[model samples]
Structure formats: structure tokens, C-alpha cells
Target: MMSNPEKTDLKNLTLPMLERFLQGRGKERFRATQIFKWIYQHDAGSFGEMTNISKDLRTELAETARISKLEPEAVEQGSDGTRKYLFSLGDGNAVESVLIPIEGRNTVCISSQAGCAMGCEFCLTGTFKLVRNLTTAEIVNQIMAIRCDVRAAGEEIRNIVLMGMGEPLHNLDNVIPAIQIMIDGNGLQLSNRRVTVSTCGLVPEMERLGRELPNVNLAVSLNATTDELRDRIMPVNRKYPLKELLRACREFPLPGRRKVTFEYVMMGGINDSLEDAKRLLRLTSDIPGKINLIPFNEHEGCGFRAPTQAAIDAFHTFLIDRNVTVITRDSRGADISAACGQLKGNLENRKEII
Candidate 1:
């Protein structure tokens, strides 16, 4: 609300950094918890609404700090109850988040960058050039916005998937802090298991994530079994490749009883063959993980089509026969272009598909 005020964006600060910010302003460091609660828990958009804090302190905060907002451009609901929100950023660029609910749990898919640079041919997000990495506030704001939306609809979110738009590891500097806030006991209190970060096998970054945030679940987009196949579709594969990528997953310190999730998008005649499934099983044999078969979400110009139902079934059956834990994940929000690998915002420079 402060116009051109020299205040810091409070949402950008981690709890400890916020503690320092409050202390620097001559406020008690513990006050950061209260402010965090107001922003993340109470969903307060402005300092004045934190009525529990002293009015004088509220005025102080109003003058010295601000919470940035993402302008809502559109909200589309899939007939299956999934919702997609398009949020406009300050620079006129936009990003999207998808809210998916299943049975007792509500899962929100959040973006880490405006577009994507991973260049996975099957992903629609890959077509748009990577404009910029989302700041910590921009990343966290998407969750907060979705949180408010879900609560208003009388549902509580139980899971969060960093599976939208860009590669999360590419924006680790901002994404990790946002994840810390999501899993902070004093804040969103999301169980580490409930929050998953999906990546296209950013080997070193994945290792770094293991060291820094070991508790959160990880899902790798292992869409192809062979490096040659992967290289053509996922450029990151050229750098990390399958061997090194799976090695990181194997070495990752997953909490007891937790296994990494291998997300394999089923692209027809590309990587959905029954033999591919067998190879996939062998590829993941050494790693403790489950296979999530995502039938490709099709869009124009992507040049890839979804695997046929029989192909998908045969792959699923092969994995089942091999005694691998496999799940054919239901693709939600395709009706709204909000399914995995299908999110592309309506920025002026980006082509609006759908």
C-alpha cells in the first residue's frame, strides 16, 4: 500500500531474515513469527490488518515493510474440479498455478519461473523462452493466493507440487526459501512429505537440494529410458544424463519409508512402448522410487501426441508384472491447459495456446 516506500518486501524474507529485518527496525525479533502468521496464516494483505499487533507497531510496519501481490488475471475451472489461476506480475509477464483435489487431499501445483528453459519437447512450457526466475515473494505468493482460494471453497490443501512452468532447481535461490516457508512449523506447517519438488534431473542442483532441504519429497521427470531419446526431448539430459541423474536420486537421503517419484510422460511412439516400460523398471531398479505414468498432455505445435490407451495400459501392465510400484496418474486440467507440461501464461510475448 505504501507507494514507492523504501520498505522491504516482507514475503521475500525467510523467517530468520525477517527476524533480522524486524530487529533492524528496532522491533523484537520474535515479532517476525507474529507477522509471518498474519501473512501466511491469517492471509493478511496489508500491515494494518494484523490487528493483534499494536496499532503503533502496525503503523511502523506499514511504513517500513510491504507484502507484494500477484494480480489475478483469470481463474479457469476444469469440469473435474481442478482450478487454474493466471496471475499477472509487475512487469506484465504472467505465471500460472493449478489446484487439484483428490478425495481428502488438495494439491496445488506452483511455478518457479515465468516460463521454462529446460526445453523438454513434450512440455508446452518449454516453448516459451525463460524470461526470469521468480523471486521468493513471487514463488510464495502463488501458494498463498491458492491457499486463500481453496479455503474459500471450503477445502484445505494437503499437498504442494513444484511441478508447474519452469525447472524448480534452476531457481533454487528463490525456490528453496519459499519451500522453507511452506514447511516451516511456525508458518504453513506443510509436512515435508506432502511438498514435492519435480525436476528434470538437474544433477548437481538436485544434490544441493538434498543437502539443504532433505525432507521434502522429490519427483524426477524421467520421460525417456535412453539418453539418446532423452537428449532429443530434454536438453538437460545432455548435461546430467540418465546415469548421473539416477545416481543422485539413489544417493539422496530420502526419509525412512519415502521413495523418489519418477514421472514418465507417455509420448506416443516416443517413449511409451512396453519395452520402454521394462527398461524404465531396470533404470529405476537400483533406486527406491515409484513410477508415475503421465500420458502426455497434448497442445498445438508441441509435435508430440498422447500415448494411446492400449499403449498406456500395456506399459502399466508391464510395470505391474515386474513388481514395480507404478501409478497411472490421472491428468487433471487438460480441459483448461493446466495439466502437467501444459501451462503457458498469456504474456504479450508468449503465444496463447488454447
Candidate 2:
């Protein structure tokens, strides 16, 4: 459905917020739960599709509200079955989400903002810089829109990672509520373990995420082993240095069998040395988290090359031999530019040249 700025986007509201809206309209609070179930669980696109609700109420709701869904401006599929979607945000901006199907599980990597402000030296999105933070409806609609496609393909989105276009913690105001709806049993019904929020070391907001949504898995993008290196790569490190970031990580409350995940992108000739691995072991020894070494996904003009297989294997072996938990993540959708911000950047460049 088309966006209507004059009407309330019901997807923007959490359960309580929706309940209050209904109550203020002289309707029963239970109606909010019903509407939520229809919207989230049943995939109701229009208020009229919510047949269980009274026709009169549905008419009233439709006038004041709209159930907005993002229709992808374009979709690209990789040979490995990973699909990247470009969704227009209706204000001359767009964001992307990647759907990865691996070994019977589907994971959707969702964006929290239209473009990134993090300015990581290796990232493509950083070149474009920040456009704006996505609203709650925008974030939730990524899941809703993709889930429809997943269902059609006879699969389901089993996991979600906030590791796409933007830093999740930077937009916690909208991200947290979108997360709350995701884990809400009556809504998305995803277990807290299934939803992962990846941050580029936003320490203070990371602490708030732990305190507020302690059960959801947290993944920190700890790409560098030293502050000198990290400060050069991830700009956020300059503000919340390694010592303070690790302190907050150590304090983060993880639930049973859930350790924080440290995602280290191995950049060839950059942060992929055995020395860096040894330093990484020392850095993460105390924190209850495992290392996920991602060989950097190379892109045009980024100036950073993907780590050699030898470098990746060496890093994994060192961490494993030292009794540190670690795994090498397979780079998915490379043919489709599935790496964060690649597709969006390419589209924008094409438009410029056109």
C-alpha cells in the first residue's frame, strides 16, 4: 500500500502504543492485540483484510491508519540462493536487506538506517554516508515484506541480523521497538535467541540494549585487535576505545548458552595477520563470546581486499588451538553484491551516470 504521512503507520507502534491508540479512540484495548495478530501473524495488508474485526471499526481504522509494506524497488539473486532486496523508503532514499538460505535455515540481514555514518574504512556504505535513520515501520516492514517471499519459497526467516546498511545501536529508539515486536510471541514469534543485533561497538547503547533486551543475542563487530588499528578502521572505536568497549561487553548480561559474538572481518594485509589473531585472543579471552572471522567481501573502489584463504585458515586455527571458540563465516551472495551497502551504492552510481 502507498505511504500516507497524514495517517498513522500502525507498524510504527508497539503493542502498548497501539493499545493506547485504540483506547484513546474509545475502542477496547484488546482490539490492539487483534489488529497486531492480523497484521504481523496473518500478514494482513489492509484493514479490510482483518475480517474478524468489526467492519465499522475496520473502516474507522483505515481512515486514520495504514498498514504499510515495502515493495522492493529491485531484487538481485545470487547463484547460491542469497537474495538482496532494494527497498525505496519513499523519500528519495533506499535501504537493502539480504535473505540468506543456508542448510535449511534462512537469515535476513536487515538495515537500521538508509545509509551508514560509521565510515569504516573498508565499507562501501560509508562512502555514501548517512541519509537518515529508518522509522520503526520501515525496519519492521523489511521483515514483513521478506517473510512473504520466504513463505512463498517454502522457507522461513529463522534468524535476523541487524548487520546491514546502518549501525543498529545508533538507532536504538526505533530498533528496540522493532526488536520487541519481533520477539513478541503473538507477533513475529521469534525466540530471543533467533534475533541478533550487530553493532560496530556502540558501547553505551550496547549497555542499554543489554539492560533493555538482555535475551536477544548481541554481536559486536570487533574488526581490529588494537586501538591504533581500530581507531583507523571503525571510527566508533575512537569514541569508545577497546578498554571501555570490552568493559561494557563483560558487563553485558547474556542468557544461557548465549555468548556475545565478536565479528572480525579479516582484511588482507590489514587486520588479518597471525599477530592480529594472537592479539585478538588476548582481547577476547575474558569476554563470554566467540569469534566469527569473516573474510572481507571485496568491492570495487573500496581499496580493501578480501583476506587470503591462508590468512583466514591460520586465524581460525590459532584461535581454536588456544582454546578460544571461533568459526569462519562463509561469504554469501558475493555474485549479487550481497555485502553491506554494495547494491545500494551501485544503483546510486548508475543513476548518477545515467
Candidate 3:
């Protein structure tokens, strides 16, 4: 049987906080940095591996602080080099994160909530009820686990997308701190430019994110072109309509050459019409933006199918013809139910609390 006591997840604690904790325990400040470096930079899984620290200090840390690790219950790899990991948290609550390797960059999709509250009609995650927002440590552990895997494979993760399970803006308190930890040079060391936070048009949080975290990339999941359609598809739109959301995007204070990425998932015969494409072009005309046209990735209970290649191509061309910079995102890990909005976690199916 495991003899571990309930302790703070050290992987979730920031470097400075760790230092303070050590200082409180009458340990030298440098010991904190060393432990931090070992856990984060060297990927030490246990305090016993922190060799530089004295044996007594190591024992103290072992008893006082806990290093969080994800026990991957299941891992599925797609033919297109996308991998999905179903990680079981300490409380048996499970969450899913994916790693997609494209060209030279690997983008890890991180989840902020166990299940999404945003009831976007076509989303697989939205089909399930929101369980609870993930803690900052839980969110950061997903990235750390993937980073460890990348190192073992002699590769590096170049980007991160908060586009996996939940609406990020809804969990801004935890999400914001998690991003800060990722961007911290002493930790994950990911650049803000490479971390994209995707939202379903949470207007107040959108504006606040722009003002507070200026460097992180922002992406709005704008599935429909008009308010009527948007409201029907995304219930959040009923509160923060298209006009207000777009206005927030336009007024977003982005730095040099950093344009907000607008994610448009194409649903076959639903929002894939040329008229919808034109309206999309018009809606985003004045903002500095790039459109990511994602062909819908279907799930078991979700009744939506991806748009045809021809229809997707038409939508891409329509945006580019109007001088809009567009890229059709290749849906990865779809076969394993790990594509966008498809991560509902195994815990849900098991009827377990997450």
C-alpha cells in the first residue's frame, strides 16, 4: 500500500512559492532554486532524486511537499502523429490532453476544466456537464507530463493550445496562473507568443486577458458568422453577442505582429455555406487576424460531421480571396477521440466524478 501523505503538489507551486516554503522551514533560499531546477529542468520525479539537497532536507521536503505526476490510464496515437493521453488525477478525476506534431513544432492541447460548461451544440465535451474547473497544478501537470515524454523521445514541444476540453476564459483564475507558470523561464520556458488561449467569446474575460496577459496568443472559437446562428450554436453568444465579442477582439491590445487567431470549425451543410464564409470575412475585416478553418472532428454522441474537402477548400479560398490569411488546421487524433472538443475523458463514461 502507498504510504504517501496528503501534501501540496509541488509541481503546481511556482518557484518563488517553493523558495518561500523552504525558507519558512529554515532551509536556505538556494535550496529552493536547486529543487526547482531539478523538478522542472531536470524532470526529477521524486525528492529522493534531488541529490544536491542534504538528506535531512530532502526528507523534510518529501514529508512536506508532494511532486505531482500523472498516471496515464490510456494513451492513443493517431496515424498522423497525434497522440492523446488520458491522465488520472489524484482524486481519480481524469482529464485528457493531446500532443500534435506538425512540421517542426509540437502543440500540446491543455484542458482548463474537467468538462466544459460552454454548451456549444456540436462539441463533444459540451455534451457532458461541467464537473469542476481544474486546479492550476492539474493544468500545468498536463504540459509537464508531455514535456517529459518529448525529452525521452529527444524532441521538444514548441507550442501550447488551451483548446482541448474546456473554455479557458471561464477558468481565468487558474488558467492565467497556469500560463504564467508555462511561460516562466525557470519552468516550462514556453513563450507567450506560442501559447494560444482559445475562448468561446467570454467578453469580460477576453478584455481582461488582453489587458492583464498581453503576450499570450488569443484565439476566438467563432463557429458561426451571424448572431442568430451563433446564438443557436453557441449559447454564450446569447449573452455576449457577435458584435460585442468582435468589438472586444478589435480593441484587444496585441503587441507587434501578434494577431488574434479566429478558429472556425466547419460543420457540413450547417455553417459551411459560402454566404457564411463571406460574413466571416466581413466580420473579421478590420481586426488583425488569422483564420484557422478546422473541419469538424466528429465524436460518438455528437451528431456533426466534418465538411467535405471541396467545401472546406471553398471556404479557405473564400477567405484568402478577400486577402484574409487563412490556414486549414489538419484534424489530429480524431480516430482516438482526441481532436478539438472531442476530449470528454474516460472518467465521464465510467460515471466517476471528475
| Candidate number achieving the greatest TM-score relative to the actual structure | 2
lDDT of each: 0.88, 0.87, 0.85
Give residue 255's error in model 3 in angstroms: 1.6
TM-score of candidate 3 to 2 decimals: 0.93
lDDT of 2 by residue, 1-354 (tens): 346789999999999999999999999999999999999999898998998899999999999999889987778888999988888777778788899998879999999987788888888877778888999999999998999899998978899998888889989999999999999877898888999998888888999999999999999889998999999998999999999999988998999878989999999999999999989988889888999888888887888888889889988999999998898988788888886446453337534211
lDDT of 3 by residue, 1-354 (tens): 112546877766777777788889888888877887787788788889998888998888778788776656677888898888888765657788999988868889988888888899998788776888988778888888888788788899999999988899999988887887788887788888899999999999999898879898999999999999899999999999999999999988889989999999999989999999999988999999999998998766777887999999998998898889999988778777788878887755743312
Q: List the residue pairs that clash in candidate 2.
A: none
Query: Where is model 1 more than 4 Å wrong at Cα?
Result: 1-6, 348-354
* Candidate 2 runs further than 4 Å off: 340-347, 350-354
* True lDDT of residue 350, candidate 2: 36
**Which 10 consecutive residues of model 3 have the lowest summed lDDT?**
345-354
Judged by whole-model lDDT over C-alpha atoms, candidate 2 comes out at 0.87
TM agreement with the true structure for every prediction? 0.95, 0.96, 0.93
Which lDDT tens digits does candidate 1 get at residues 1-354?
123436788888889989998888888888899999988888788988987789999988888788886755678889998888888776767899998988858999999998898888888788887989998888888888888877887978899999998999999999999999999887788888899999999999999999999999999999999999999999999999999998999999899989999999999999988789878988999888999999998787878888999999999999998789999988888898889888887654434532
For model 3, state the Cα shift of residue 27 in Å. 4.3
